[model samples]
Target chain A: MRCAEHCEVVANRPVATNQFEIEIHCPTVALHAQPGQFVQMRVQSGYEPLFSRPFSVFRRFPERGNFSVVYLVRGAFTQMLARKKPGESVFVVGPLGNRFLVAQPANQVLHLLVAGGVGAPPLYLLAEELVQTGVPRQKIVVVNGARRQDLLVCQEHFAELGVRLRTVTEDGSAGAKGKVTDALKALHGRGELSGNRCQVYTCGPTAMLEAVAKFAQKHDLPCQVSVETLMPCGLGVCLGCAVKVRTANGTDYKRACVDGPIFDATEVVWE
Target chain B: MSEVKLSVKLGPLRLQNPVLVASGTFGYGSEYADLIDLNRLGGIMVKGTTLHPRAGNPMPRMVETAAGCLNSIGLQNVGVEAFIREKLPFLRQYRCAVIVNIAGDSYEEFEQLAERLDGVEGVHALEMNISCPNQEKGGIHFGVDPEATREVVSRVRKRTRLPLIVKLSPNVTDITMTAQAAVDGGADILSLVNTFVGTAIDAKTRRFKLANITGGLSGPAIKPLALYMVWRVARAVKVPIIGMGGIMNATDAVEFLLAGASAVAVGTANYVNPHASMEILEGIEQYLREQGEKDVKHIVGTVKRCKPGNEF
Candidate 1:
């Protein structure tokens, strides 16, 4: 039951460097939102930034009928969204796109979740879902990477979930001084990552996603990636977010709005 | 409470109303089934189709602007055979008219596509997309030249009896010449104006915003420019015109109607609101009832307040 409604903001606060989280009382959207789905939101009434921006659903409070979105202040629309006061109305259309699919083969599947900078929200929510669904917290590993320590905002959330958390930053201001893919390599060297029974999930920038995809392919492990694109309308219409994917016939286009925001890493045509 | 005639006659084609969803914006109709009532719209123009499949342009294909957005989709579609086989059957279930928008690199490609779809069931009309650049010839050269526009439309017109609508490109100078040319080419209806060519660059990154440096601009920013073109073409040719560009609301649709357009297509507004077409349709009906007009046709080209300037 997707819906377009004017949600009232409950809290708008800075959670990290240049990143802010907004919680709104949108019951319909909160009820329908899954782990990897997103919402198209427009904050301003005027015609500037004429298109709605797509944001992944960071948190959902089904009991209180509220949902949260975390976004980095990158442009005018995001700046406007961050400046919005509590109790202000924000137009939102959600819970859109295909969600992250869990491929649990017996009880041997190890879920390796990866997050890159602003792409953390969806993967965090995914980890939460995996834990709530009876997957042992020890079987799940959360990997986060950012430019600096200030940008790693979801460390505490993953810790509270009792999931094993590993982090890396480019500037050595965080846990490990390298990329998340580096941490992945180290885990594989230690025989922690298995090609046979482990499943990988990630949400991040295209470069990072491509690296993860290539790594998973090399290891013969299955991986699912939540991609990001410019989507004016989160629904299947607009055709604004066309992503190329490898099909049975050849390479073809799929709309990121509907076909998936989440797609199997092997199927993505990384050119 | 008088009965208002919302039906409109566009040459040989008759629409239940004057509000239509533009091509490229609306993806084959099923994408919007849950958001709005499909039967309420006058027509549905699916994505642009070609003879073969297209992968479209690279990523970062769209960017937001002031009151508008730009796109370089490069006409990404599954081609004609797929549409007739896989897409058409689904569209047949809807009550609204299903209009197929086709593009090509040459007159022969256009003719072949039109011939293939000539007797296809559920295809209500064929929109000849001359706005696309001719891949065989360089530049946005086909639709810009009156001769090419005439030949393409005439060839397509000969192949399809289902009403032919020649979509004109707005990049050309003196749009009337092209409008008159399309009518001469046997176009039943003329739909204008396609997106205007525009570009945007990121000052900080020192790079273009879109993967394709120049993309088609659509939305509320171009409404005034589209209105003037529709009005100009409406006065030039006797064939009915389907006006579109930056139509966001019912008032914009009414403005196009008053400017001599028989019908209007909601393009960029669809991206803004999935239910925009239905809202515009309802708005038109409400406006007609409020104005005490029995027929929407009465308002076509009815402006008598302004006189022609003495420059002529």
Candidate 2:
């Protein structure tokens, strides 16, 4: 069941430069939330910014009855959200959208997780779930990229999970000096990725996702992407978050809020 | 303290309250069932249904503006057949009036839709959505011209005995002309000021925010304009008016009642607050008690005008 509640903020602190992770106490949402599912948050009471913004559930602490979201302070909504302190109440509707595919224990598929900038939250959660599900720690490789060093979030979190971590930066402030796709090529050159045995999961900016999708398609690797779009009402009614995908007939639009924020790369029609 | 009567009559159709959820915003009523009591609403105007399904517009279909939002959803729905087959049964459990909002690409489609749903169980009325600004055909085109508006409403009016409501477009030279035209064509009620056409631009990217380039603007920003139009139309036509445009709370809802609207529909507010319509309904009753009005009807079209010598 989905819930709409005014949850009290348990903790809200900056995890990286210009990025903050805020946890809210809502047992129903926290316990039900899965990787790639998100919550719609109302930043303020008034209509300065009228619509609620959708944030991915980065971490779920069911025992504490809390779920955290990692967000970048890009616009007015985020700017206001960053100032929210512990004990402040924020209206949130959650455990929405579909979740990413978790590897089965019996399967021997190699899992490659890729994340860019603030997009690391959901992927990090996916990595944690994979490790818990008995996917070997060596089989799970997380490639994290950002514009600079500080914007790269969730690297330490993924490291703490005892999985392989690869970092890439556009300015070369840290890790390899290149895009995430460049690091993937290096991994492929090292024979770390196989066509039929590997599965790729990515979340990031549109440009980067498009590139990642192309690479996954070229290698015949099964890929799932977590897409981010402007959504008015995260609950399926608004129909504002549309993502075009390939259909048997030709192409059709699907709601990213409900149908998925996570979609198979083969089905998505990249612009 | 006296009891406040919230029930209102819109032509032959009557509502338990005067607060109905606008079409497209409420979905099939099941979407909000988990959040609020569906039986408490005056009515539930489900999403716009057509002769066939629609894929709608491309990505970036919505954008946020100051105190409002713009959307070009293109009336995407599962057609009338699917609506009756899949969506209606869930609504039958609720006591609220089930008003099917229908949109057509032509006069034949409109007539067929009305005829198809005329005797359908649980459907109390039909709200003709001729004012959707996002569609390429049959939407704003029919609403902009008074002759087309009259022709389409009259065509559907003949096919169904259900109370007919003609939703009017705000993007017109004079809204009164279309309101009178709908009434002249046998409309039982009027829902005014659908949405004002607007656009948004991204300064950094130097591109239109919406994929459709221009979308319809709906929210608190258009409240005053909508109130003015409803007041103007109420005097021009005898039919009861369902005023809507950025009505966020009970105060805004009551303002429409005083401005000549018999009832009001909660549109964008449903998205902002899932329980907005319920709160607005409670607020209306509270306002009635505070004003010493026993019936909500007592306050309809009661706006006082300033006299020549008494003007401030």
Candidate 3:
């Protein structure tokens, strides 16, 4: 674990509604972090708020040797962080928390991914890794849903994958005019998806995850979900990020930071 | 390559390392065990306990803003008896020092709790949490008033033979005087800073983000405040000081040691990065090698003040 020292915030630009991306010039983190991990960064010039905000690594561009975080304005910490302009630097703690499991499943052919709204960051990372592994673009199908076009983030970036993008929006602002799970059903009906043979990975709102879990159960698909819990310390010491999990032996809860921000969808006991 | 061993000896107890997890940050040392390497730390300072189990405060118990976190975790530990029965044996296997942090609502409760914890085998040390703010106890008793702080430390000193380390609260106006008062009352060591009281507002709802309305803020935002207080108290006190507040890494710990801290504790850093203490321990060793220093002991109180002509 390392804290941000002289790392400068070289770029801060808004990409969506109340959502912005900040590229921090932290060479150490840019060099070390993989796809699914995140960093906790704080803004310097502000009397309005106090506390560092945790954001997932949206993308880590090795060519430029910098990593970026895409975040939404939810609390005072983020609102303040989002307001930070170019040239100002804040402290950061990284490559913190365990990352998603991307090991190639033995005898596996399909990688089904589901993402919702801005929670698409980690899954996009998984997709990027899958692309690099030479998985056929046709085998990687992304079913992403957002409230509207304003909330539908990163679809353009995913489009560049040359893979199929199936989308749904709660409001008919863009894509399919229903929910993501509804689009998932459409895929199943059209024989585009056969859940029994695929390994599913998802990241989104808890409700959407529950919906995916229900689908995994019905089809007996092996599914893993990324869940979010209240984080005071992005470190494992706080015990604030416990989530109930059911394993083959028994069921017990584990921390999101250490045990996982990612878990088997069937194992998670969402309270 | 030099092995970065985190263990150190202070007095009666040989701490596995100087990287003891801070109190209030680590729950009973058993709450999140499987996630961390308990043996890696210097010791474990379980959350502040009393004679009775407390449910603590209401939710939203925590909120993050800027470079700090605000928490109103109102001393929520499962009392002394339950700890003796359940939490104790679980921690004994870990092969690290265990410091039990105790808080009491009254002087009598303090004495009783100390008496009970006296012979607990696995309990390596006793961290006196006298700095806990009690709005109900005459508007400010143990933490704010030096008299009350001294009295509590004095009474507990008579009851327990365990090494006493009094944790001081910085909510008071003069931290030095309060520190001295605890030392005079027979405290062997001191831990500075419980959280500084703070609040975060929800402008959309026009209400407080935390249900407690105001909470104690920790993390980088309070690093300067914590550092200044540690330096201020270190100058006025003789007891070994365990400096803590916004200490997240080895550099932060170095700053504290330079300011006269004998040891340092990692608090909110645990929340942001669970592997913080180990990283800090490594960071300290890296600094020592770079500075051509052999032992970390020499760095304590080495913060050289810049003279008028010393400006380069």
Candidate 4:
């Protein structure tokens, strides 16, 4: 069973504008977590903020029993987390959601890693796993997008891992000027979008997920998109984080905390 | 030093202590089972159950407010029978009392559901929730009307021997009238107040935050309002009360007890901290010990009312 525990912060520092990397030393959570799972963390000690915020696992160092989260300053909780100093206690509950489903026989499949905003963490973590597991670095293509250049984080992290990186920004301040879907569109136009058994994996805001889902549908390709929602418990109990997805019987609301932060792009209702 | 007795009684039911995880927030007692010691709690009130399974509301079911939250879960559950078959067995192993919160669309359904769980072995009590809209009454809720509330409580009272707790909704004109009606209909206990009816809109998008348009307000924001209602009902009714609304810590639970709640249930706090009840339970013990009290029962209805300023 996954446990909710308090982990000591080793570092909580800004890596980019309005973005911070928080490293916590939690042995149990780090040892159990797989790519795509997340942790629900309490920002303050009391009821002022009143809910534990959920952040996807950025990176896990199993040998040292530590995990990192890349977060943007979006609300009070994130703002509190950003100001946290090393050695302070941060309560966390984790390996909470279902892990990213990487299809077996990784050697033959082309892994398409897509990210938006701070959503790059989990996808980048997945890329690292793919490389370590013997999937060729050339088989992985990492595409990231944001509103501007300063907001785009983790580009160099992917490069450091020797994975191919592509970037896009809505304000024309970075690589190809557009959304991540625009980069994918450009790839499709150049006939570099298909062949060799490709699959798409993405995580971001709802608008970006919808566009990625639509693009995958247009190409008739298999895709999995990680989703985000307001979750107080980060457990299936609250029934708070409901995502509507198409089932064989029609559509049903699934809890993002337990059922998935990752789901098939085709099954999502996207509204 | 002697042991401080934490046990509490509600009609024929007895709890290990006065702290319980509230309905809908605890989710069948299995979700937080690993995080906290369930046996330490006084009881576990599972999610709101119905005669049939409910699919619940649309997306954006919950949103956080300043120090509280709004939720329109629409009484989501896998129905009572499925709960018995799938969930009760797991909960039966725990030493804590397991109270099931039941909702219905009509009085008949309420009685029928009561009869179904009449002699169920593992279940300890039934909490009747009349806050849900009554389909038979053209969408008027049962808890809002005194007559409807009395009829449903009386009917269910006759169908089962289990201790009946009528959970009153605060979205009413006079909560005491509903409390009186529930007692008159033979309720053994009164659990108040359920979430207050509330809503929020996204000003920028010109859209409702919740797909349901309106949701029930919970957490610390509703505590003062809920405490007042509990006090009002305690003055009017003879039955025991399980007070809850925005109770985040032991101090809040103590406030409910001082307002005449025989027991307190931690609701929104469970979302904030999975092990909230344990901390609150310990806190209550600490308060009692510090106050030189030998029992938690000493704090019940102990609020001191101030005299008029002119008289003073």
Top candidate by lDDT: 2
Which 10 consecutive positions of candidate 1 chain A have the poorest summed lDDT? A101-110
Candidate 1 colliding pairs: none
Interface RMSD of each: 1.4, 1.0, 6.0, 1.2
Segments in model 2 whose C-alpha atoms lie over 4 Å from true places: B137-140, B306-312
What's model 3's lDDT at B48? 84
- Over the full model, what C-alpha lDDT does candidate 4 score relative to the true structure? 0.88
Q: On a 0 to 1 TM-score scale, where does candidate 1 land against the true structure?
A: 0.94
Q: Where's the lowest-lDDT run of ten residues in candidate 3 chain B? A: B132-141
Error of 2 at A269 (Å): 0.8
- DockQ values, each candidate: 0.67, 0.73, 0.19, 0.74
TM-score on 0 to 1 scale for chain A of candidate 4: 0.97
Q: After superposition, how far is residue A158 of candidate 2 from its true place, in Å?
A: 1.0
lDDT of 1 by residue, B1-312 (tens): 678899999988788999999998888888888778888889988889999987787777788888998888888888999989998998998888889999988778888999999879899999988895323234335788998888888888889899998899898899999999999999999999898888999999999998778888889999999999998998899999999989988999999999999999999888787768988998999999998898999998875565669447
Candidate 1 runs further than 4 Å off: A248-250, B133-140, B304-312
User: For candidate 2, lDDT tens digit of each residue in B219-305?
Assistant: 999999999999999999999999999999999999999999999999999888888999999999999998999999999999998
Instruction: Please identify model 4 stretches exceeding 4 Å from their true place.
Output: B133-138, B306-312
Error of 4 at B136 (Å): 11
| Per-residue lDDT of candidate 4, residues A1-271 (tens digit) | 5767778999998888888999999987788888899999997986678889888888888899899999889887888898899999899888789878886678788788889988899998899999999998988989999999988878788889998789999998988899999999987787777666778999988899899989989998789999989888888888999888888988778889988989988878977
Model 2 residue A270 CA deviation (Å) reads: 0.8
Q: Please, what is the TM-score per model? A: 0.94, 0.96, 0.65, 0.96
What C-alpha lDDT, on a 0 to 100 scale, does residue B107 get in candidate 1?
77
Docking class of 1: medium
lDDT per residue (tens digit) for residues B19-137 in model 3: 77788787767644645678777788887888997656655567876777877766656799999899899999998788999888789988999999998989988998877643233
